[model samples]
Target: MTGARMRVALSARGVEVDDGAGGVLAPWGDVDRVTAFALGTVRYVSFDLVNGHSVEVDDGAPEWDEMVAALPAHVDGGVDDLPAALAALAHDDPVLVVGAPVLPR
Candidate 1:
């Protein structure tokens, strides 16, 4: 199977450089570092019905912030990998928890 690829861009502050013409400043003041990576296929699955009953679960859905928080800390490769990354989060059974809150006595 063909693996997915991704690119990342990083920026920072540094000293300036002079241009060749009469010590003039360079057109582009700062520079950015870009990197690429190849990631294998990732998948995530969620079973809405547990023990043959529909249960309220946290599947990283409903809101963009919640979904983003559920994703892996480090994600790279092409945009296609986004689905796979999300899938990975879904498959991550450890992080999944019941959304219900405990009632006070």
Candidate 2:
């Protein structure tokens, strides 16, 4: 039998470094939101169900604000981009949430 490799969840809290032309990038800053690994200001994990897909994000609110504050410059994104209580099985997993309030087409 072929054994499947285990995948550790990538919980890198960040903000959307947008191009300002309507595109964005990452590491606005990465954060840890495992609750137990309370390394930064991780507020409530934001989650949303859109287009039949469920997405959760952590944006340092009530707690996560510190992570967002440390950045030199960043844009505010919705529940999906915060990278909070969210989970992704693999790289190929569908990213239902992208920008703030913008759902996958």
Candidate 3:
């Protein structure tokens, strides 16, 4: 069966900070902050079907409820349906993608 999947890249850059000893800056210092980025394909499941319903597995899937709950109350079954579903899933789990980047504030 076809399903939603995304191929993403997670990148992190260290932040520069003071040495506190009042010494010269170095190339690699303590990492106070971090920046990340996610780049890749974002495929979503096709919500539209000719008399077909989406199937979801519950066993071995702890976040099933959250994922389903994320769906919109009323699905239009249009081109944006998939995107809406993906957005819902993202809301439930920010890092839903396998290689989704995690950025630090």
Candidate 4:
């Protein structure tokens, strides 16, 4: 999705991304995995759905910081080193923030 105009947040049901006109609502149960990373000056969070689709949002999103802070509480098996990875703006290797290391398809 477009980065700057996006608004990502953790709703009571799951993750929501509003892009002004319309948005996507990925319910918690539909999410099979999650990842986070940073590249240049942008930090990203990706939600991988059980249906094999995905949604990604970046630091440009309005509620990005809030979504990142609330991730550990909402997701299971999230990596503890997320803060470190996100701080490394020069790197882009995605860090697992939820679900198993190897997803079961």
Which candidate number has the best TM-score?
A: 4
Could you arrange the candidates by lDDT from highest to lowest?
4, 2, 3, 1
Q: Rate the local accuracy (lDDT) of all candidates.
A: 0.26, 0.29, 0.27, 0.69
lDDT digits (tens) for residues 1-105 of candidate 1? 111221111112111122223221111122111111223333222212223322111223233233334322222224344444445553323433212211123
Choose 3 or 4, whichever is better by lDDT: 4
| lDDT by residue for model 2 (3-56), tens | 122111222333332233453322313321112112133222323223332223
Candidate 4: give the clashing pairs.
none
Residues 1-105, candidate 4: write the lDDT tens digits: 536776777766777878878987878878888877666777777888889987887777667677767776676664675556566645646564655223223
Would you list the rank order by TM-score, best first? Answer: 4, 2, 3, 1
Model 3 compared with the native: what TM-score? 0.18
TM-score of each: 0.16, 0.19, 0.18, 0.73
lDDT of 3: 0.27
For all predictions, the C-alpha RMSD in Å is 20.1, 14.4, 18.3, 4.4
Between candidates 1 and 3, the one scoring higher on lDDT is 3
